[model samples]
Target: MSVSDTIVRWRYRAVPDHLLGEILTKNWIDNAIPLLFLAAVVVAFGSVIPDFYSASNVAILLRQWGEFSLLVLGLTIVMVAGGIDLSVGSTFALGNIVALALLNVAGWPLPAVIVATLAAGAAVGLVNGLLVGYLRLRAFLTTLVTLIIVRAVVDMLLLKYSVKIAGAFVDSDAWYFLGEGSILGIPFSVVVAIVVAVTLHLVLSRTRLGWHVLAVGGSRRSAHNVGIPVRRVICATYVVSGTLAALAGLLFASRLGGAGADTGLGLEIAALTAAVVGGNSLGGGRGSAAKAIIGSVTVLLMVNSLVRLGVPSGANSLLLGLVLLAAVAIDVRWLKNRHKVLSKVYVSPTYAALPAAPPTDGDSPYAVNDRLRSVELIGLGDIDGPEDVILDADDNLYAGNRTGDIVRFLAPDYTEHEVYAHVGGRPLGMAIARDGSLLCCIGGMGLYRVAQDRSIEKLTDETNRSWFSVVDDSRLKLADDLDITADGRIFFSEATVRYEMHEWPVDCLESRGNGRIICFDPAAGTTRTVLRNLVFPNGICMAHDGQSFMFAETWACRVSRYYYDGPKKGTVEPVIPDLPGYPDNINRASDGTYWLAIVGMRTPSLDLALGMPGFRKRMARRIAPDEWLYANINTGCIVRFDESGRIIETLWDLGGENHPMITSMREHKGYLYIGGITNNRIGRLKLNDADPSWTGPKSYWGRT
Candidate 1:
């Protein structure tokens, strides 16, 4: 390799620029900004404030953060359900007074006091839920009214029993421990808070109810349309919020040993600020418990730092309000444009230089001809997009239809057809096994089989995961074609793991080696990747030797051979180094040769652009996908080649009438059947001087 070319290859292909795009596409990316903000706050405050990192100060901060996070967690759930609970502050105050009264005045045991406090908070929440969710009232106004009424009730009760509660005292050691306790050198409240945080995080992220909550938050109408019981989900969110807030209030009462009229004043504002600032979208459907915790710590530090700086309480509130405004603004704008930002960076193209095309003009074997013009049609308008066609012992013609079914054309006249089996994914390639079962490769799914009884069974859906791939590649993304060895080992091609079947054109633009070959052993019931980093590997055909196979790397415009169990085992060598067009499927011919389907022809412009990946990258980012340059797939042909990879002859539909793009061709009984991925019918052309009784099944299993 030349020095400049090597540098370019290393710069684009060696460095992992695609990892940034993969990371950006993940859900956890929402936590990035909040985490950065938390880090900045800690560093800024810890440096400016005297003794900020002292053990005593750190302990106090943790105590406040532990209780405050509960309220933030509650509000996050309500916000995620597309609602808000302004009454949380009032509910907290009521829980505090109820806990104090039950413990000090009523002399109730700790468990009873805790339960009563929780029940009192739940009662208020139930009222809010009914008013907003069931009655269909505006959430903001209803919660605002509840906040006022609940706060008034707490004040009246506090006034009535303030003297008695202050004079009375609980003598239990457990009560004292609940208020001010340590467990294994950690504050008891911090441990409890961590446990609650982890439990709720799992519930919110991994459970069905959590998904329902997010669905309702994202769009209530859509959720209702999908039969999600929208009103109940919204109502349940409020109950969850109220219950968590009450828990926080109980912890606060234990720590402080008392309650007052101002016990939970403006608590709702602080919690909401923390939730939004921590990256929970105020617009709903986008938040997590970890984000809430990060926000709580940041707010707690900011508030405590201001207090230590002797800032007035009124100014502190004002600053907090401004911070909330800024946070809401950031949340709204960031969520709106995240996809746009991702679109710009996600398609990281790499350098790819395809070899110059071979000559296909007059006298050349690959020269275009009109041999396929007057071909016979099978299942003309009855089928759609038969990407591959095959034949069984009885000469029943089988082809994969675009509607995810294997369509069988009765052989006698090729007129009648029936749905042989429903695979649910686009079936691309087929091979007849020795036992009469039909093995097929399903796009977006994995290898499967249609048994003799017409029952469908999955062979394998996953393989060993790559250790360094940023995206999970264990699950087959696009299984394009398959060929089984004599030992029942099926080798298949996954065309591209980075894009689905529909987005395959985009893969051509990058021309990256995102495809691989996987082998499945029915004996051991295991699947493993046999070859890696091929550019759009499409077809898998066992060679006549039965020890090796040839695969078409479509985007690379080449065919290669891999030996599975011979002296050349575990090695790959080029078979057809360069072809005039893009290759798709390869099948054995009757004369011990192979037939390759050229799905598309290459152009000089596309070939030139492959060497200049920057142009392709800019074109992808600046233009509509339809306007991007693509291979000339609308007109293709079939080529016959020998075992030595020499093109002997070619067949073409000159006027593009019978089959415009040939993806697969099977030779059976002196005729070649052609199929296309975008055509409505299968084509059959006569092949003179070929074995008259030859059949694909007989060629492999020897006339069973």
Candidate 2:
């Protein structure tokens, strides 16, 4: 080992002891997952329908996204700061009604018009905020009362004071400029909304206001203990929320050529849906503006596209209901289940042509919580063809890429440096051997060993498949996962023998039972199948006692255990089952827990496919021997499970720039490491609340 690396490891130990959960929640892998998922939705639709991206369509989409994002932004701030405003839609309606009443009856100028509108909105926000913050009322109950009263009052005022508001403020050039005009080729409203997005981003990310908001949301008692002036921040968020709602109202009125009783009608549903879909945590302390916008765009796109696609008028409400239901599900569920399975994505321009397999370590348990959240994604940009990840004795990481070599990085930072070893083929998983050498698993090319001096030697090109009863198939079907046992046996799984990794789900749908769990004792150097008749086994991890290990069965969405000793020996038991996403790998977390990685999610499309066995059988029969169909696994993400198989937390990528797909996760020391087979580089993140202090891949096991 290099003297510099040794010194750095010593320094990490010298630092203060950090909390495991604190580190786990740090989102160490990549942050841009949500946006990418939204983008993928956009791209998928745009590609499928020509009118989806036309100029007129784009304009409408931007306008709709901007307006809904404004409302969602308002709500997310309150939500992340630990509060909810059920009266947002009513407040929004009242903003327009009040402004229209003033402009029509009193002939108020543009300035007064806006002030009056905001003032009215703020008044409602004040009542709601005071009742909840100072009077200690339940937020939902208080806001519900306010929502009823405000909606009624707004309706009454709109009816009682109806005048031609166009001349005064609604139809004036000034109002039009603010509502629909452009600045630098970008719509003025879009620019305004984006500016608000950037400002909120800064406030939530860098300022004391952001910290206090988080404190207030995380715990009211802790916020009080920290002297955070929780009530003030709470009130401020609502007031800001009201102001923005009024701004949206004003724009809504102008864009529609004046307001009416229906102004901002049903906005609460759309706005709240956007906030939740954007990945905001209703429990607070973890929402981002980026997510709000992405969620808003996604909502608007689906709604608008369905309308444009000539969906039956009767079905429109039903479809909208589904998306809304999904958004609400994403938000409310994440509130209680942030630590559960997370789904996300990766997108990069350079990776446009790469074919990706869901990141799997051939037996690692992968979780599949497809529910969206309100957190910002972190992305790992350009790098080489990266594949696998490994951790040293001290929990530092070493990984591999398509360049036929293994590399090293410091966890937390995950900054890449000099190549550690040069193998002769495409390395996927790197494991530390008992002899102090590194074992490398190469896709399509068998296994090999790299000495301390970086010299490489072949380990085994063939694993026995005699049990399969297939003739003339003498090559190791596929070497996908890796683990070291106390007895020096290498335990791994062949993802599929019937098809290569890319066409795995076909085997999944076929339920072919072709996967096998194999082991190779270094002393004898012969690989043998310990368990056959499995379907797409992915990750491999030994139990702490060293007598048994667990592996992921991807096709069936379960984890199976193989005992190397004891009376239960040679028998397999279901460790975890019915995962929401495709199971990728299972790793031993240093915290005495097991972290499972779920590669893709249970999309409705796949659900349909699963329900129809004949359709799959027929498709397989028609396809050419070498042909493959890409499913939506690219839109899913990763997660972690405990030793008892109880879901603990989720780490997701929404499926784009941050990470298109996360197939593997290895936790080591204080950070987490990530890998995707088709990705050009691996990713690293610090888990703010993760428990494992050390002894992991930094737990980035799949490096691929």
Top of the candidates by TM-score: 1
lDDT of 2: 0.68
lDDT by residue for model 2 (57-167), tens: 788767656666778888888898889888888887777777667766677788889888888878777786788787878988888888899988987776667555545
What lDDT tens digits, residue by residue, belong to model 1 across residues 319-432? 889989999999988898988988887787788887779877788888888899989988888999999999999999899988899999997789999999999999999999
Q: Which ranges in model 2 have alpha carbons more than 4 Å from their true place? A: 1-33, 47-50, 166-171, 312-317, 327-704
TM-score of each predicted structure versus truth: 0.96, 0.45
Clashing residue pairs, backbone N/CA/C < 3 A, model 1? 179-254
Alpha carbon lDDT at 610, candidate 1:
84
For all predictions, the C-alpha RMSD in Å is: 1.9, 23.3
Task: Give the per-residue Cα lDDT of candidate 1 at 145.
Answer: 97
In terms of TM-score, how similar is model 2 to the real structure?
A: 0.45
Per-model CA lDDT versus the true structure? 0.89, 0.68
Q: Which ten residues in a row have the lowest lDDT in candidate 2?
A: 343-352
